[model samples]
Structure formats: C-alpha cells, structure tokens
Target: MKQFYLSLIAFFTWVIGMAQSGGDSTRLPLTDSIQAKKSTFTIGAVYANDASYYGQRSDERLPYVALAAAYHHRSGFYLTGMGYRLLNDSARLASAYSLGAGFSFPLGKSFTADLSYDYSIYPKFSPFLQAANPHSVNLTIARESVVDLSISGDYAFGKTNDFFITPQISRDIDLFNIGRNDLVSFNPSLDMTAGTQHFYEYYQEEKGIRDSILGILMPPVLGGSPSEQNPTIKTTNRFEILSYNLKLPVSYNRNHLKLEVSGQFSLLSKQAQSQPGKVNSFFSAAFYYQF
Candidate 1:
C-alpha cells in the first residue's frame, strides 16, 4: 500500500511539472467518480473563492455559491442543472444558471467516452468572463491505467465562437478506509489547454464599452489618461496553448454522501495579452448527497 501511494504521488508530481514547463484548463469527466449500479439522483452545493475560464479572469474577485442537481441513469444518460449566486457587491442577485445533458459509455474494458451539451444563462452585465459563451458542446475520451488519462474537445458559442482542447492526467490515492462504505482519498490532476481567445475578446469589448460610459459620466480628472479610460485590447484569435493547471482534491465518501475540498493553481501563457505569464490560484469546497 505504501509503495502504491508513493507511485501515485510521483506520477502526479511529474505530470504537473511537465504541464508547467510546457503550458491548461479544467473540465472533469461527465460521469460521477463513484458510480452506482442503478440510477441515482444527486444534489450538491459548492462555494468557491473565484471563477475563471481557461485561466482568464476579471479584475475583481468573483466568489460564488452554487447549487446543483443531477440525475444519472443506469443507461449512461445524465441531466444536470446548476444555479449560481455571486457573493460580490454587484447589484445582480443571481449570477448564472446552467443546464446540461450528457451520455457516458464505456469504449472498452479500460476506456470510456462522454458526449455532452451545456447551455448557460447569465444576467446582463455579468462580470464573469465565461459569460461570453453561453453554449458549449464537449466530447471527452478517457483511459484508465495506473493513472487516468483523458482528452476533451469543446466548442463554445454565443457572442463569439471559441474552440478548446484539453489533455489531462490524474490519479486517486486511498487515504483511509473506515468501513466497506466509507473511505477517504486524495486526487491530483494536471491539465493543459489549447484554445482560441474570441471569448476573451468579447469580454474586453464589453468592458471597454462600460468603461467608456463611466468615463463620460465621471470627470476626466477621475479617469486618468485616454488610454486608461479606454485601453485598446489586442485579441489573438488563433488557437494556441493557453494555460497549464494543477489540481489537488481530497474527498471523503460515506455511503451516499461525498465531501470534497479542492484547490487549483494555474499558469497562464505569455501569449495572454492582459496578464501574460500570470499565476492564479482558486479554492473550493463542495458536498454531494446521492439518492
């Protein structure tokens, strides 16, 4: 058991180091980690320090609390819904809502594939960067070995269209086994993402419009230079490596309930115009009850 644990740790460290040296994004497989033999319904809640999209974020923190429900059929079809409330000082009480449907199936003994579609609804003037793209279709292929390997392709569209591809490696290490139905484990994963930044361009355009309006309302003394008031945004529409991410999640499973705490560290690519070569961290805690 000790040797197995050490091997998992070594694999996690090596993969993340490679990602940082090279350039990532976050999207887990559509199916639940702990699968049930029969159909199941799950309700969950999450609290996060901030939200980002492919490692792009707004200037201010975007903390949020979210509630989610999912129904998973034994036939591998699932439907999910989530609602988010931002904890910031913005006047918007509800930040976003999402509805998703997916089908997960085994490709073979050690491989699986998931195809999913999601639509997001965001309040007008929402500050979240991901709000620009409201519709997304994703296909993920995963392989199980000593470590899990997965790759996903996503096409997102709304105000603009963007495509992203993410490759990831992860491992789960058992920490403690209290009983047949209760256990704790640590999961570490690393991912790299390559994508087009049209969504980011949309965000900058909206921000510029808002800033211009504010500058007109406020005085020139308050708004500094013309560049400061309405800075020119350089947009890169070509697909390229965007970010690398390392994620650490510890989970406790007790029968039909699971609790998890996770943190992610992201290194943004130098090609990112506004925050080139920036590093950002995000943390979240969540719980799910399955019935």
Candidate 2:
C-alpha cells in the first residue's frame, strides 16, 4: 500500500510538470479578456444522500443544509462565507463555518493561477481523554476541527467555451494538536456551461497510532476519557485515495437560477487494522440564486 501511494504521488508530480511545460499555447476563456468588471452577491445550498455529516459515522442521509454568500468582482478577486448543518435521524450531528479569500492572476493568454486561504471551525474534543478501554468509555463521538490551505493553477482549452482543467495541491492541518497528519492532493477537472463538471483526485494522508486505538474502542464503548495514569498507545497511519466526482456547477450572474448534481467515490487504506480505512460513495444536488 505504501508503494502504491508513493507511485501515485510521482504520477501527479509528473502531470504537473507536463502541464506547465506544454500549456503556454492553450486558449484562454473570453471572460478573462472582458474588462467590464462588477461585484455581485450570491447564495447557494446543497443536499446530499447517504453523506456522512462532519465525517461522523453516526450521520445518515436525512438532510444537510449549506448556506453561502460571496462577493465576486470581474477583476478576479473574491471573498466568501459558508455555513453547513448536518442532521441524522431527528438530531443535529454537526455544524461548520468557513471563510475564504482568493485571487486569480493570468498566467499568459488563457491560463490562471489561484491562491486562496480558508479557515474552518469544527466542534472540539480532547484526544487525550478519548483513549479508554472498550467497556469503560461511554462518551458520545466527538468531531475534529481542520483548517486547509491550497494553491491551484488551471488552463482554459476553449476560447468561448466553459471547459477547463485545473490541478490543485492542498495541505490540511488539525487545529487541535497542531500535529502534522497533513495530506497532499491533486484534482483534475472538466466542465461545461450548463453547470456540469467531472473531476478526479488522488490524495494521501499520514495517520497515527492514537487514531487506531480510538477506532477499536469507539464501536463497543459508550463513553469516558482514559485514565490519566495509563500508558498512551503508539502507532503510525498512512493512506492513499483515488476519488472521482461528477459535479454540477452553480452560477448565478444576476437574478439567475441554477441546479447541479455531483457524486464521489473513494478507496481507503488496506493495512490499517483498527482504522483500516474506507470505501465510500455519495451523490448530491444543489439549488442556488443570484441577486
């Protein structure tokens, strides 16, 4: 499994090099040349079936709500805010809030590079106390908080068409420990004007032993922190992923409406005994409007 993930990393690195070497002549979107700029506000929402809320196992397909607002300007600078609520059965599982700002700079004729910063807040839990014997811990499952930073560059293969391909790399940080279980990923995308887009990504995550211990104790135990006097378990975790997404893009210029569909599939680690990884899938749709 480690070898496979290493190879995947190499492949993505090669792709990035190739895209940069030969993409100088690619066409640029007409929108990039249009100088008439305006700032607009928009709102959007999404619904997914069989989706895990906040990455919690107890989450079901009941309903998830996302509220968003953005300020976009023609010069390629934007600011956005998003909030999400995940519900399962009849109770709220988790909620998240995010804020971001980004800028797009022309690479040449048609390509653009984007740099963005995002901060997200998730409910907190003490990992130290989470460790306990299977029969002793009876606490409800806790959620993890994460913050992500990413930089991406994309090229437009069409002049008037909306089709383009983008490749991005990102690092995710756990806010709790400031630990480096960070992940690096690549995303390649294709899109059309009707809000349909298809994409595939490869990702790798560094895991730790503490996660394995929690995995073993979580299913059987109800709750309670581990005894402060016990020795802490030690282990390491690393996993690779190949994911595919068919997404519908929502664009609202002004008084316009949009709807899109998206789905994803992922494969997890094979050697992780306690947290052995996952194979999961989901589909979702969205509705949105521009004012």
The Cα error of candidate 2 at residue 141, in Å, is 37
Tens digit per residue, CA lDDT, model 2, 84-136: 67654233344656676766555554334555555555433212111111011
TM-score of each: 0.84, 0.45
Q: 177, model 1: CA deviation in Å?
A: 2.4
Q: Which stretches in model 2 have alpha-carbon errors above 4 Å?
A: 1-37, 50-63, 89-94, 126-255, 269-278
TM-score for candidate 1: 0.84
lDDT of 1 by residue, 1-291 (tens): 355346547767775544322111122323573245578888999999999777666867889999999988888889999999999746666689999999888899989898999999987666778778999999999997656799999999998898999999886666677898777877788888898877766676666566676563432557686456544344468888888787889888887788889999877877664476788899999988888
The alpha-carbon lDDT assigned to residue 276 of candidate 2 equals 29
Alpha carbon lDDT of each predicted model: 0.77, 0.35
Where model 1 places Cα greater than 4 Å from the true spot, the runs are 1-30, 211-232
RMSD (CA, Å), each prediction: 6.9, 17.1
- Candidate 2 lDDT at 81 equals 81
Clashing pairs in 1: 24-192, 24-193, 24-243, 24-244
